[model samples]
Target: MHSSKRKHIVVPLVLYCPLATFANTNPVAADDRLETVLVIGEQIKAALQAEQALTPGNVTVIDSADLYQRNIANLGDMLRYVPGIWTASGSTGDSTFFSSRGSNLDATNYDGNGIKLLQDGLPVTAADGNNHNRIMDPLGARYATIAQGANALTYGASTLGGAIDFTTPTARDTEPQIFLNDGSHGQLQGRVTTGLVAGAFDGLITIESKEWDGFRDHHQQERKGVYANAGWQFDDVVKTRFYFTYLDNDQELPGALTAEQFDENPYQAQPAAVIGHYQYNVETWRAANKTIFDINENSSLSVGFSYEDQTLYHPIVYSPFFSLLINTEQKNAGTSLRYNLHVNDHDLLAGINYGETTVDGGNYSHEAGRRKNMTTHVKNNADSLEIFLVDRWQIAPRWKLIYGVQAVSAGREVKNITVADGTLYNPGADYDSINPRAGVIYQFKSNNEAFANVSRLYEAPTNYELEDDSSPDNKALDAMHGSVIEIGARGKRPLGTHNKLHWEFSIYYAQLQDEILSIDNPTAPGTSLSTNVDDTIHAGIESLLGASFSLDANNNHRIEPLLSVTINEFSFDDDSHYGNNELPAAPGYALKGEILYRNSNGFFAGPTFDIIDERYADFSNTYTVDSYILLGLRTGFTHADWEVFGEVRNLTDKEYVSLFSVRDRAAPNAAILQAGEPRSVYVGMRLQF
Candidate 1:
């Protein structure tokens, strides 16, 4: 039995692997190759190659093998080596907050801004751009892709942070397997995956269950889920896949504690939370399909459709005096189409994405731990449509030029179903915009390239922001618009050596108008609110470096070192209250590094470290979370048909705030913190047949 996180980091290992046949997520099955006649094959190549060659931007690809080495709890664990994204995690598996490009610096909710989430090449985010982060199962994913900024235009995403996609394994790549894991705080996980391939038909299914007693008091969760997919090949040129997903989760919330309370007892839940029995629970079901057709040798077309249903029950106590019981039923549908063409030295792609979501919900008042009366019943509908085109021309042998344009339309509508106290839903609002991009890349050296790009970004307000008619200060929230310019480089060392170094680095600057930020009302405790900032600046650097070293004469013993870090200097350009002060929440600088030594006989051990600089807790910067460092040790034995791993975290047992809620102008007494978990141990094992 064991004790106990790389994704989206561009490395030479992925680029040079010749056996990477299933890297692309689409309707095409891995074993759909046609051995009969000259079938119009080659329709299943990964889009990453085209996008990387044409777009002057950063791209990261993480394969399943990469995930086996780390903890598979949340997206935060999977995106550890990812450069641009920042993740702050909570006690439960799904209680994680992550964002890209410094978007919405103060809010820690699941509604992702500036970043789009996708599963198997289809949108997981609702039409209003809100994502249920729990829907993803990292353990079931075969690979993941990260597209940064405008480079994600091909995916119909034009946010400042970019897009990320999770791809599942198919029958061709799956074998009968079982996994078991046990960790600190009574955490247990069990999963099984099996698949079968028969002639032109293939099917795969996965089932998983998890239970955990969290590091913090009252933070407990139980989860059960299933993922299944079936594929058929009509011919060598046509293929399609149908998928289904189901999840049921029960989670207890441990409300945030005041800074003073956290200092005295990091593991204790707020008294009000315990008394009110705060909880967040949901049951979700989803179905999706993807099809691919090869028009000819030079072109291909892919289409995807999805439908999702979810029911949620949220009970929380914002303060000792205020509580809420919110129940919601939601329906969401989405469709996407993309066409790719390659002729001569030119690469072109055109795509459209459309999604609509409807919410039938109400918010009720609660007396202490019991529901009192219904306060507001409302229905909200949100929709988004986007069309985009990208063209890449290789004007010279060493240079490429990329140009792109996108058109978007978004709308939100609300209806007062049972208004007890006037109407709490805002009047409907609609938004439309057109954005353009240009970029250039040069192959300045062997296996190395330099890139630069400029793009315009637009983000629409989520339903929550546009429908906050009850809040006088939040009713008029505006859509956000910004411009970004970036330059970067990626490559590996010289070719004739056993030891190689791989690296990628980029720097970006963004100027934004109407940047959305959290605004707290001193009178309404625990109510989330947002307001637009007139001007803001976001500038940052993203980097990943890795090296392989030979330590023995036969190269049987080796060492691998990896370092990933992000440096941010985000601030309000000029505002009445914030002036040019740095933003709150995410640390200004965070670094993670690991060094592993391994023998060819399937034995490996490593030392890993995380360092985070001090950060302000609110816009007023009245207080700060002290800087912290964590040291960990991991070791494992990996062999054919069987593997096992163990790890220990927080060797120093340092006291630190893992996450916090942002406030408006506040004194030191107002900041609330979620303390980091104490030292822990984890162990896991897997069997394959």
Candidate 2:
């Protein structure tokens, strides 16, 4: 007989209930009248949790409640606690340069590649796997989910870094709220949000504004955004939701500093940035719709569509004589169809995902950020199609077999409208790949489980990586292919009657062929080129451990300690040019942890620390970035309808390099290092009605 405990509800749809916010205000009467709705909402959450548990790889779910308690200025600040991830702020604070599983470690620009970003399970990253412009603001998300590596097969993501999905908050879980934040370096931010629920319709709207004069000279940034969504429930089995978003982001780029300048003053921008008036600005508009249909008790279908339009204005130093100004108009559209079914002892998921992006770009010669002449104009387009299927079959009482496959086709096309230099070359390509995955999950106890999997990954180069090369040895770029093997375990155990301990640990190894890598040209100091590497290996361990202990018999006071660690070993596998040499960029190890004391009356204080080891800065391993330690503290008070928090970071004011541009060979005077922020403090408060 099939085990009843193993029977799980599968729903690919995300719906918001109408009475959740109301119940928060009038608890007694609302609870009496809308008890069933609340239960159904909880059931939806449980179903999502079940889906995550069924996966044979590492997955992390972060709630907005936990995020709001900290200073969330950017994506790097928001996801700092997650394991197997590395992130640093780029030229501007709003842009995050991130890497996962040793992917995209050589990127020097603000637009990063190698990972998939999604909103409500739909693609937000361009079809070419490029994270262009500014990443979405995390302030409006209700929760976020991260599927590491090939574990994201269900989402049609076969990239090395896997996928991240952010779910927006609806009227169901939101109320009228206001927040204000202020910190060092003239930083200020504010947000206002409200929600409505009537009959079968519900909606939520939020507006946010933020600005900061950063720690370094010439580093200034501003942002304004609006997030709104409306849902209509036609019946218990049918629901449709519409979303709209608008964002305006503007920032001044502080060019990287040389070793001499950094030692003299890490808070000064390079002279080139001031001379060229470097800046990156963008405006964006997005809209999306999702509809769900419950065909039967054990089957459901979900359809989604999304569109985005963006305009970018960027200017930067190209040479001592002049600057380069880049202007681009970009558009993206995507659609998804997913179906979930349960039969006998198997749960199946099938989906199709399609997306396309077009960019009309122009390069202009400029002086002091003023456009003078158009040098180059081009139009680039990328489209992708993915078909995937996943199955979880119960083979024994305590064991389950998980298997999946994905078929992908992608095309990158470039049209040279005008080439001022008289060189006409078509550097476009089409790629196709079929990847398969298999795993086993064994549940040894009700609260403990272990899993192992082997999967394949493939990624097509982005348009940026396919740029025209004028070298004699240049050849057509090929797609990246790799095979990954992973093993992991997660569980919760009672530490004592009034406390609990929870832990998650995983290890992964990948053998890659034709992996895309970029390095600054040895002949040209400012320009970079991309090429495929013959052989490489990426291996890493990710772990998180946490526990809470009550300080009193009444459990009115508690102490909690949480730790996260990531160890990386990325190296070349006996290549022609670089034989068994370690890769540059990511550090060998990272450790972060916090110890907190909490009281039942909603007060908490914590001390946190982060330690990052040394890493190389050049492919030849000639230069090294020294390891550094950072200290911080957080104190906060929370209540049902209000909260206040304070934070201090880099207490010792240690000067160190946070990030750097990759190079084939680095000079001692090269201007490639980006300085880390110095000592700073921040405070914020929130109110809800």
Candidate 3:
């Protein structure tokens, strides 16, 4: 098999090391060891700060304190202000299509790649690097950490886009709260959370539900979920926590529209979507446990175990009479062990991660989402073992040396039983790699630092790319590799008694080999092909700048302005068919900015804008989508026990392409574009005690 290469631009990587010492790095005195109680929230924060300080690569942390005041309907709403990341709403369900470092630019919104998604420092993405967007809830997290490029090696993720980890709060940091929201298109949602503590035991639980009648026809969605956790502290040096989660999500697919169709009526569903009743339904259950122990005064160990089971039912149509139905059951289990040692201005971290995933399912010929006949039975399995070591040495008072390496062994196997097709192309593959990282950091003054790093990245093909029934020519795909270098600086300065300024900037370049790409078959309306490119180049600049100042001498009124920009230059490096051509789907530049006015009475209002440049839609650079700009407004009021917020999006009712399918070549009016949402309004409120 061979292939070619989203639009909303995304880019780059940088360094963000917190200025905190490792938790428990110093021994506790004997007199202070009696009648001690551990605060879970503070401990976790301190530990994470300490861990991130040793990372020599880019990292961004999003706190929940200001997020709740925004209209957070999906992941995009929460991550919009983060530099080097691009997120687009799917308009149906709670789905969000996101990209980092130009990863998975051509993949469909239903599936994601390159990025590793995690929950509470545990792996949520499958062993083969597949993740579902609808199953994630942004409101459930206390904070989120985005580690770009080689920074993710700490979590055993070796992908180009890196890793995102969402941390949940325990009972000690939780309060009884209720939330409700009502928005345009018949949207309604509700959530309730509570926590309890008894002596050394504490527990927290949350339940949420949502229903939406989408802006497009045949695009209704529904979701419900429960998240719960319990913790126990036996002593000052040992503690453990248990977690459980369940989610049920169902959504209707509106399918893509041709350029002409989009111009006529962007909200109309595709004819195939209506006739085939395209839909996706999923149910999942997950459980995990983490324990920490202080081995001695200068060392600590952390162990984690996780299990997940999921069921999926999806039906789609390729043509008038060619419909497909997929029913599958997937199970995944994983374990992780991390040890930390601090000695004489040196910090050493070593870890091992093992994961196994199994998928059993069958594909069937379908009519209007109903199974008519079985076509193929599938049994796919994947497993991975990763070992990593990192050491941060302070060579001088103002400088440090950081180095790390990760070794991985992975395998993928597919066994299928065919019914109608007379082809037996069951394939299995094994991959092994040792990626290394090196960097240096220099401290100029308090609250200011500069860093640089070079690292190797690798990613193996997922099972979905290998088990294609539409084409017998689909052979086993090879893993992609890349070498990258990045440099960055970050700091904050006090402007005055009531004002401050902060900024972060970085640039990165990656020379990639055998870059995997998936593109639509130009001859077919809905079919796509996958292949590897011989050579490619990805480079970008990422920046975040913000400031706040008092509007009056009394400091009763304040104004805040923030800006984030990404510049990308992704292209083919003298390829055979497309010589020095720009890659499709990712824009050349993107900018997001906002200005807010805040009063002493806890009221705030802001205007936000986003701009995305024009981009190509095919590898040959024959077709393109025009640039687009969006405007929005947000207003909110916050208090100690409750909050209220309102939002208006797409204020100009702009009609533009939100996403599209990739292709090797395309016609003038190809059926590849997905329309963006129209104007809408939302209001929400929360109460806590």
How do the predictions measure up, each by TM-score?
0.91, 0.94, 0.92
Highest lDDT against the true fold, candidate:
2
Question: Clashes in model 3: which pairs?
Answer: 6-585, 14-58
On TM-score, the leading prediction is 2
Please give the ranking of all candidate structures by TM-score, highest first, separated by commas. 2, 3, 1
Model 2 gets an lDDT of 0.83
Better of 1 and 2 by TM-score: 2
Alpha carbon deviation, residue 4, candidate 2 (Å) = 60
Query: Residue-wise lDDT of candidate 1 within 1-689, one digit each (tens)?
Result: 01110111112223322222232233444334322101221112244444455568887777665566656777787888888778887745576787787865765354566678888779888887777444677777777778887778878888867888887777666555667778897787777666666678988777777777788888888777888999999998999999999998877778788778888898998887777777778899999999999989999999999999999877775554566787889899999999989989988889999999998878777754456776778688999999999888888999988898999999887664545657544557788999999999999776588999999988887776555433453245677899999999988894245688988889999999987776554666666666778999989999999998888668798899999989998998878877898888878999998999988998999998999989887787877888999999888989765688888888898888888777766566764788887898989887654
- Ten residues in sequence with the least summed lDDT for candidate 2: 6-15
- lDDT values for all models: 0.77, 0.83, 0.79
Worst 10 residues of 1 by lDDT: 1-10
Which model is ahead, 1 or 3, in terms of lDDT?
A: 3
Ranking by lDDT: 2, 3, 1
Checking candidate 2 for backbone clashes, the offending pairs are none
